[model samples]
Target: MGGEGENTAVDLTAGDPADVENDNDRIITEEFKIWKKNTPFLYDIVMSHSLEWPSLTVQWLPDVSSLPDKDYETHKLILGTHTEQNEQNYLMIATVNLPKEDTEIDARKYDDERDEVGGFGGVDNKIEISVKLNHEGEVNRARYMPQNPFVIATKGPHADVCVFDVSRHPSVPANNTVRPEHRCTGHTKEGFGLAWNPHKEGGLLSGSEDMVVCYWDLKEAGKTVAATRQWKGHTAIVSDVAWHCSKPTLFGSVGDDKQLLIWDLDEAKDAPVFAVPNAHEREINCLAFAPHSEFLLATGSNDRTVALWDMRNLSQKLHSLEGHRGDVFQVQWCPLDETVLASCSSDRRVHVWDMARIGEEQDEEDREDGPPELLFIHGGHTARVEDFSWNPNMERTIASVSMDNVLQVWQVADNVFNEGNEDEEEPADDDLE
Candidate 1:
């Protein structure tokens, strides 16, 4: 070592890389134990389930049920597999039971009943496969029809998509091939983007590497046909498409060409009404229109950052969020809070951003961190977070899936999101000292 800070960097050339990796694993394992031990203090309701195979996408269903007289509630979720084995791959509806309240088994006291990785789920609350239908291709993404939750749309590796009426399948879990209710075929190459119109019934949108976004009108009952319209607005791969929450004819798409195009079907079918070129520094992986505010949108990029935009004025970004070390995979606005947003990344973290907190004062420790609007960073996953979904029925709750075969559901601890959690109330002007 040299004097002062001259040789502060560790000499990595001297040690065996395998030993270093093992040490890192040991540290991570122990850190997980501590994180699980403090679960009660970190979440309103948290549960982690290790899956048999990795799922690439997840969405919460509208259905919720409870066992006879039991205080536990079971929530339905739709997820799809990405396995190479065609027989093993499926679009499935799974159920996870929740307690009447937060977990009662304190890990600090009764840590004996824990799994090898430190999860505390038992038989009552364990995840169960409710229905699984054979899928012909890898499910890159999946979404349920807003008006018809039983109907699910899945995007494949190519310009292929399968629509399944899950209600027609067996209610119980089984491994068997099931034909799709309909198929939407368009495009000439691969793509992993899919979206169902929230404002229009039987309306769907699919985008692929062919650089065209196709619209499907699935109102023919049992018969399915090719795309009714193809919007060629991008010169590269269309990564995603999102429908405006209230505007049936209005939608937006992001692509590899670094453009965010807003399409108005009422005006034109082939060209966008508004386009924001170079919306992100790199390929825009995903985009989401604010659930409550129609003019606000958020996008995540390959540049490892998330950007907030006002659709009314795209001259410049409203905010550029930087925290993730890997590419931002997806960005979504919380339905319960118009100003709140969430982004997941390949860096194995999910960040919760509160736009309302921007420009607010912060303590010394928070000032040393990144942005004041950074509400919380969730680092519970061990691998790259593939996808995540917010629970519309629950406040501040979200579920995420990772590459390492883990599905976790958690809600932020109230003190972090609730302003009433302040330790002491400031007196009004009349009562001020």
Candidate 2:
């Protein structure tokens, strides 16, 4: 894996040989089959896109209405770059257009055989829409509004949070007429993390190096932007923040101070409802609240460990997962499954975990020392993976961005594990010998 400081040229259209089944594909295919045979799930690399610059964040837009008379949906991806070159920090919106005829054929094939190998082939054609922001700062994070697909929010090594309106010019080559619609400046230092309130129409939250969190209401537009409320609690820089999916007034933040703080808008503005000090041995990098459970939370740290917590019991952690050889950068829960989650790390691997199996194991104190139960490990990136996103509408599909300047999309194969096979025994040693 390469360091973050390495600079690379823009190569947006080049495709990886492994993405489509080339010479190196045989090894990957065999390994994938073996892994799927032993595990309960399977995955395949469906698409790969090269970038001109390294990206620290990638986000998938919400599902949109299909084009008129077309049976396939048009999906879009937003990539935020991190670079030292002047004006190299850009935001790109890549649209994947699948032909209806090819999609129908693939669907029919999958329905007939239902094999792990059969599905729509990798996407070879896509349209790229890009824009250069006014500030030449590293983009640490980017996210789309829950209610509006056209609106996006980004923050980085700048004091202000930038908002872009993609509808201004859907097809890019942006001119002076199309620019960032708003710049919300309140933080005294560079911003690190950002999250949109899932339940609020125009509410947003941002964490910064200034050790403060600011809340903004974008519902009202004006010449200048200001935070509706701001709070300070952490003694160190805040690394990430996330809003609860079902609770509009609740949110969480993790920081370099090794603390996880939970805030509520309806309560006192100055203090948090629950503060878990020393959440990890090292700086906490990122966190996400479970989509299905309001009390469940997950956090990753520089200590190379991920911990799951129950908000109802702040004193004890539900589980501590350790497998990544390097720092854990991001963790996300599957939108469709309550017991599944995924994580990316500086070790250049993406791992998927099944909490149902983990819950059946003995507690950390009683169990012997060994790696946690990991369902799958994706070793496709040549460099450290910085961020990844799960598709909201698709089951077992995910997209990840890496410092190698590549974007890869992976999807789990259907019916890899046969029903009622959990009780089967392995072959005898004499048979293998």
Candidate 1 has which clashing residue pairs, if any?
A: none
- Please name the candidate that would achieve the greatest TM-score relative to the true structure: 1
TM-score of 2: 0.79
Residue pairs whose backbone atoms clash in candidate 2: 10-52
Candidate 2 lDDT, tens digit per residue, 1-433?
Answer: 0111111223323477555345334443444344334222233224556777888998888864466655556677778778765554666677655334335323222121222222444433543544444334777888989889778888877788888876774454544342578888789988668999988877989999999999989988664589888989899998899999889999999999999999998886579999999999999989999999989999999999989999999887888888676799999998877888988999777877767767455557323323435655665566789999987766677789999788877665433211125664433223211
Candidate 1 clash figure, as a count: 0
Off by over 4 Å in 2: 1-42, 65-72, 97-123, 126-135, 174-178, 359-372, 415-433
Q: Give the TM-score of each candidate.
A: 0.87, 0.79
Give me the displacement of residue 243 in model 1, in angstroms: 0.2
lDDT of each: 0.77, 0.72
